[model samples]
Target: MKFTLFSLCRRYPIWVAVLLLYAVASLVSPAMLNPDQVLNIVRVTAFLGMVATGQTIVLLTGGIDLSVAGVVTLVNILSTGLMLGDNGNIFVAMLACVAVAAIVGVTNGVLVAYFRIAPIIATLAMNSILFGVALVYTGGAPHGAAAPAFNTIAQGDILGFPASGVCWLVLSIAVAMLMRKTVFGRWIYAVGANARAAAMMGVPVRLVVVAAYTLSSMLAMCGGLLVTAYIGNPSLGIGNSFMMTSVVAVVVGGTALSGGVGGVVTTIAGALFITELNSFTNIAQASTGAQFVIQGVLIAASVVVYRLLARRPRA
Candidate 1:
C-alpha cells in the first residue's frame, strides 16, 4: 500500500506543484486571476505543451531528442518558404513539411535503434547537423510571411478561448487515451522499464523506439508551424531554445529521467508552470540571473523529492 501510494505521489508531483504555484501567483497579484491574463497563459503555453507531449513519449522510452529545436527550425523555414505569397500552394507546403519532419524522425530512430548510439549523444549530434542544414538552407536569413489562415489557427479564439489552447486540450485527451487504454501504451512502459526483458518477452523494442522518435518529430513540426504562424515571419534559429525547454518541462513535470512514467497532462502542467514562472518573474522585475537561480533551485528541489519518493525501502 505504501509503495503504491508513493508511486502515485511521484507521478503527480507536477500537478500538485502547479496548483500551489497558481495559488501563490493568484495571491501575489489578483491581476493574475483576470480572465484575460489566464487566457494569455493558456494561449502561450499550448505550443510548448504540444512539444512537451512528444518529449514525454520519447522520455518514456528511455530516450531523448536534443534535435527538437533544430527540427522546429527546419519546419518553420519550410512553412514560410513553401507558402510564401502562394495561398494556393498551402497543402503542398504542409505535405512537404510533414514529409521532411517524418524523414528526420526516421533517421534519428534508425541511428539510435540500429546504430545503437546513446540517445543524448545521438540526438545532440543530429541537432548539430540539422543546425548546419538550416543555416545553409536559409543563408543565415529567412523570409516569407505566414498565411492569414495559418495565423488564425495560432491566434484565433473559439468560444472566447485561444484555438491553440483548445487544440492542446484535445491532443492531450487523445494522447491520454492512447497511453492509458492501448496495448502499444503498455508496450511503451514495458520497454522503458526494462528493454532487455521486453525483448525477451517478444516485444518489438526497435519498432517502438522508432515510432516514439517519429511521433516526437511530427509533433515538434506541428509546434513549429504554430510558432511560425504566431511570429508571421521566419527567422533563423527562432526555435533554438525549444529542445532544452521541452526536456526541462518534461523532467520537471515529474516524469522520470529513467523513463516509463508520467503523462501528457503532467507535461502540459509543467509547460504552464514554466511559462507562468517566466511571466511572473518578468512582472516582478527579477533579473535574468535571478530567474536562472530560481529555476535551478525549483528543479533541484523537485528532483530530490521525486528521487526520494521513487526509492524503494529495503525489506
Candidate 2:
C-alpha cells in the first residue's frame, strides 16, 4: 500500500501537489471554506481549463501560442463592436469573432511552419501586431455591453452548478477522447515527438501544424467570449494574464515543453490547481507584486522539479 501510494505520487506529482494545496487551504481558512467558494473556483477553472485544453494540444505538438492573449482581446473587441449592445445579433458577432481567430491561427502556422520562423518569435510577433491593432481600434479603452444571449453562457447555471463548469467538462472529455481515439490525434503526437519522422512516415506535417494553431486560437477566442460574459463588459487586456498562466498550467499538468507527452485531462487538473492558488493568494492578501514573484518562481521551480523527477531512476 505504501509503495502503491508513492508510485502514484511520482507518476502524478502535480495532482498530488494540487490535492495538498486544497487540503492546506481548507485547514488554514476554515471560515473561507464553503460550497460557494468551491463552486466559484470550479467555474473559474472551467474558463482557464478551456484555454489550457488548446494549449495542451499545441504544447504536445511542440508549439506554443503566445498570441492567445492578444487573439482573445481582439476577439472581445471585435465581437463587442459587432454586438453593438444587441442580443439578437450575438451569433453574427460570434461568427465574426471565430473568423478573426481562424485568420490569426493560419497566419501563425504559416509563419512557423512555412516560413520556418521560431514558434516563440512567430507568436510573439503576432501578439504585438494584434495588440497594436486592438489598441488602434479600441483607442485603448474598450466599452461595450455584452449581448444577453451570449452573456448567459457564462452567467447561467443549471441544476445549481455553473454553466461554465459544464462546458469545460464536456470540452475536456471530448478533447481527451479526440486525442486518444482519433488518427489525427495520433498524428499530432507523432508530429510533436518528431516532425521529420512523422513526415517521413507520410503524415501531413504542415497541415497538422496549421490545424493545431487554428484549433488553439478558436478555443482561446471561446474563452475570451466567456470572459466578456463573466465580466459583463468588454475590457482591454482582459486576457493578458492567460498566456503565461496557460503555459504554466500545461507544464504543471506534466506536459513536456519538448512536446508529445501530455493530455488535456491532467491539464484540467492543473488549471484547477492554478485557480485555487489564485484564490488562496487572495485570501492571504498577497500583493500584486508578490503574486507575480511567486508565480514566476513557481514556473521555474516546476521546471526544475520536473527535470529532477525525470532524471530519477527506477528499481
Write down the TM-score for model 2: 0.94
Write candidate 2's Cα lDDT for 1-315 as tens digits.
Answer: 356877777778888888888888888886447989888888888778888888888899999999989987888788888887898889898898889999999999888789989888999899889889989988987767788877777888869899888888888789899899999899999999999999999999999889888888888888888787787677777879888998989888888989888888889888988888889888888998888897778777877877888898853
Per-residue alpha-carbon lDDT of model 1 for 165-229, expressed as tens digits? 88877887688788789988888888888999999999899998998888888888888887887
Identify the runs in model 2 with alpha carbons over 4 angstroms from their true place: 1-3, 313-315
Per lDDT, the best of the predicted structures is 2
lDDT of 1: 0.83
Cα deviation of 52 in candidate 1 (Å)? 0.7
Question: Cα deviation of 275 in candidate 1 (Å)?
Answer: 1.0
lDDT for each of the candidates? 0.83, 0.86
